[model samples]
Target: MDQNSARQMFENGAFLVVLDAPTGIEFGIDLDTWETGPLFKGLKMIPPGIHYIHYSVVNNDKQAGIQSGFLHSFVSKEVVVRRWCAETEQLYPSDHVSAEDVERIRMGIRDLDKGLGAYPLGSGPNDSYARWQKLTGYITPAMLAQLLPPNGEFSSATGSVYEDEEMEEAQKALHHATAEPPAALLDTTDRFNFTHSDIRRSFPANAPPEDIRKYSRDKSWLLKTLLSSRWHDNPQDLLGELQLAFVIIFVGQNFSGLEHWKFLMHLTLCCAEALEDRVLVSRLFVPLVRVLCVQLAECPQEFAASVLEQDNFIAVVLETLVLNVYECSADEMRTIMEKEIGGLRKLLEERFSWTLATGRQLQADADAEDGEYAPQVIHLD
Candidate 1:
């Protein structure tokens, strides 16, 4: 593009991102890979929207690679400076860039034009930005602030509670004997570590008295309690936080995040009435049920009722599935109901003597159809 066009674009607040990395490192933003120049500078006329930046480092063999990515929302004329840490094999954010360095780079974009790659707006939207948006559309800054790991920590470094639970008793005993309990555990008054009681503390102190009363250790009560809270005007705020937890698990590779996400999802499913009445929440019932189905199928004996619940929690899933089967009409919804939900119903019936009203209705319907088409018996036969 001509200098005049570039200057015009810059005036509209396009982003200039500078990456300080080894020459051969494969750097990319969204779906477009930058052709590595001397300084690895990317000057893109971003359309003032959310974007994802990703990179992978070639290992010593130049064959193996380690990948990391992040999401950011850009404003016009935003200059983001990041540096790749060869030692840690990670990328550091613009926080490390000195003001002078940023100013110098910002002032000299024209002079360094030869080294910078323009944003690939010509690239089809589907192949690049649109795909990234689809993957991350549910994630928002508020969700990130509440769910993303503090500082530079990712999910891998923070091992899950379930993971810690899985250690052999002997190994745990040995490790506990040698290790001092962390300071967080030693404190008597502060017990907020994502457990039942801990989750209650998430609500603002000024929340309504009725809302506060809803808190409980039972996983089934989680969604009910959350809905009762005055966290935001819309229920989706809480759901966005839940989605962040889920995304952190699957995308962030944080099993601990999944544990939390699943805990919440399980609880939400328990509230069968909400899945029927609330439009905001009913929409999520399908995905939540799908996850539960996969979890149950993958490990049939993995589930157990919450200690805090008065009756069998497994019955809750059964009740919800029955409700969903009768009410759900969408093709995707019916498909999941037939495949995952239907499988769960069968599992419950065979394993626990549980019965499905919907299953009986389906059988009745089929029997009625067969009777209608029954052939008259012939005496000659």
Candidate 2:
């Protein structure tokens, strides 16, 4: 930006004040990261929006520690203050800071301006600012509150009680040997409110057996019920949750985030009926495909490899989605869906050497297999 525009933004933009953060620690907002210097305090001239603020503690050996972060919504000209807990190596709200001290610091903000870095806004659509917005477009502040921990923070190390139960015996023994038992420090009650773990039980408890069987075979009912009940009034929120889970996995590197993402992908792709809904097609699937494209493009190589592995959950679901769109959707919707799916296919082929068969190809393969497996008529009959 030019000097005049910079000055205008500086006057109107939000501010983040970090108190007592260790020098040399890694700090970042959105897609930009930097090593903290002696004079570093926080960020300034931040554009108003929802943003991911992440950091990693620098250990004695100068290696970065586990990544930790949280999502926050900033309003124009707002000031957000947080304090670093040296003992815990985490950032927390500065509620304990005295009112007079905070006021004194605010009054001296100009003196501290040199210590704060301006938020980076890249130059184009493919830049950090624009990409971050696209990745988080559907996410709202309310959704963050519902999904994040009670402390409103997430970390690579975050785990649930259920995860603890699933841990290997050797891992449990290792944790027991530590001075501070990780499990003991963990908040057992803290868990993300993703969709139900079991799609088979998505139906009501008292529902008829046939209804249960139908729901098991086709998740259209489950999809509709979740939209009406959990994400009521806006179908877009479903996409929002999916985006949120992906960001959590991509940025936070949290395992639970991956599980949540997988569950949502299955739920979305299996719902053939949703392909027929105009509102859902436009608001959910269209943007969802775009989001997935970006995510797949930017995801780590290991993650991409896992997705492309033979018969993997994501790969299988994507194939199912293609078949559903081709067979069940109207011509106009199918055209749109095919165009989007084509882009995804191209990306997969270019990046991973994985080919996703078209709907016709899949059908042809199934037909050939059936013919090969067909029983011959008996001459006696």
* Most lDDT-accurate candidate: 2
Give the Cα-based TM-score of candidate 1 against the true structure.
0.57
| Candidate 1 residue-pair clash tally | 2
Instruction: Tell me model 1's lDDT, rounded to 2 decimals.
Output: 0.53
RMSD of each: 12.4, 5.3
TM-score for each model: 0.57, 0.86
Task: Give one digit per residue, the lDDT tens place, for model 2 in 213-309.
Answer: 7667567778877888788857688888888888887777677777667777888787676788877788777778877888888776677666424
Highest TM-score against the true fold, candidate:
2
Error of 1 at 33 (Å): 5.6
Candidate 2: deviation at residue 37, Å?
Answer: 0.8
CA lDDT, every prediction? 0.53, 0.79
| Candidate 1 residue runs with Cα over 4 Å from true position | 1-16, 30-39, 118-125, 150-220, 230-233, 246-256, 279-381
